[model samples]
Target: MKIWGEIMGKADDVMDICLLAGQIMLTYGAETYRVEETLERMAKSASFSNIHCFATTTGIFLSFEEKKEKEDLMQMVRVDDRLQDLGKVTDVNQVSRQFVAGDITIEEAHEKLTAIAKAPMQYPLWLIHIAAGIAGGGFSYLFGGGWFDLIPAFIAAVVSSIVVVEFERHLKVRFAAEFTAAFAGGTTAILLVLIGIGSNLDQIIIGSLMPLVPGVPLTNAVRDLMSGDLLAGVSRGAEALLTSLSIASGIALTISVFL
Candidate 1:
């Protein structure tokens, strides 16, 4: 009885992990035809061989092609326990698209991805604070203000953004460290302009926080979709836009308050 229950539990876990792999594949912009392949590869990496029970790479594609039947294709046992160890994939649009494309069910894939994403990672507080401050100082310096003023402004921006990041972390209680760290990049940019240290506004703003700008992700995201890598494109683009806007908002608010 104990062994039977254990197997059933393991089976459920495998299914969850397998679906998560599909979600990540989609988020990373893998093609519908390729998502299953990615999922299989990731599963194997986690040391589970039971995932073969799920459909084959070819079979998954065929199922998607056969969407009219509404048949569930998640029943291959060849994957065995291989499906029990998938991690999160941070590409939302790709995941959505692939699920809609019938490569995987939205509910299963999305749920597993969300679950895995909640796992923790290192959160760098001081570095993020310094980055934001540096962003501010760089912006002010570019504008032609004296180093004295620029230094203060830089310090202010860094300090304020750090507080904001910390407060946000406290309230949200998610990846506080990471959230603040990434957010600090934008805040630093905002702080520079508010302090009014530089000459060419455009150049100063642009130069100050270029490091924080998610340019590659934004450009690639759009380009990927336009170039037919829809899954990957959407994922990166959304992330870029959000990050850009965040930086702008952070700085704008500080400047407005100072002015």
Candidate 2:
């Protein structure tokens, strides 16, 4: 009985490690296949057999058996509040590879994963906002806006990004935040154009709205579809569609009111 208890305790730890790794990957925009592969690899490295992993956009299911006793353990992890953070995905992948290569023990892997889970964003929020502004200005130029439009586009993009971030932080509603950001961006562009600060309202609004586009989610959805993860693909695609609609609706509302 004591031996079985010890085995179960070890199995529980391994299960926790796998689940945490999978959760981090899913939350940070990893493909479902990648998450499953990583989970299986980690379990195998820990000497667990009969590994079964199934991952979707919203959850992960994992099971494995101990090689000695053939006892099985299964666990499911529910993932919510997903966002695009390829940096975290890369970090988790590196750790998984290291563990599989026998460079780290399961306890060490768990420690590292815990630290990563608690780590803050790779870039500061202010820097992200600044980058959004720069992207907005560059996109405006690319979209045929004149040199004079750059400042307006930059300002609008910065404001929109701030609004979205702040709104989401407080409300925890993604669609509403995105819609508000788009509307704010469009309105800012129009006002800037009216005040002669921008040459082209359309270009400024287009550029500023680029910051809120679901580019990563949409790309990931297509990639998931190509990878044969139909469930994850369809769900992510739907999410992208809704986000796009929210942004479009906000912009349309702004246009109706101002233009």
Q: Which one is best on lDDT?
A: 2
Q: Name the regions of candidate 1 deviating beyond 4 angstroms.
A: 1-11, 19-37, 43-120, 135-150, 170-212, 215-227, 235-239, 249-259
In candidate 2, residue 95 scores what lDDT? 90
Q: Report how far residue 23 has shifted in candidate 1, in Å.
A: 7.2
Every model: Cα RMSD to truth? 11.3, 1.0
Q: For residues 54-116, what per-residue lDDT tens digits would candidate 1 score against the true structure?
A: 223122321111122222334432211111112233443445445445576535654746755
Least accurate stretch of 10 residues (summed lDDT) in model 2? 80-89
User: How many pairs of residues collide in each model?
Assistant: 19, 0
lDDT of each: 0.47, 0.92
Q: On residues 73-125, what C-alpha lDDT tens digit does candidate 2 reach at each position?
A: 99999997887788988989999999899998879989999999999999999
Cα shift from native, residue 11, model 1 (Å):
4.9
Residue 116 lDDT (model 2): 90
For candidate 2, report its TM-score.
0.97
- State residue 46's C-alpha deviation in candidate 1, in Å: 10
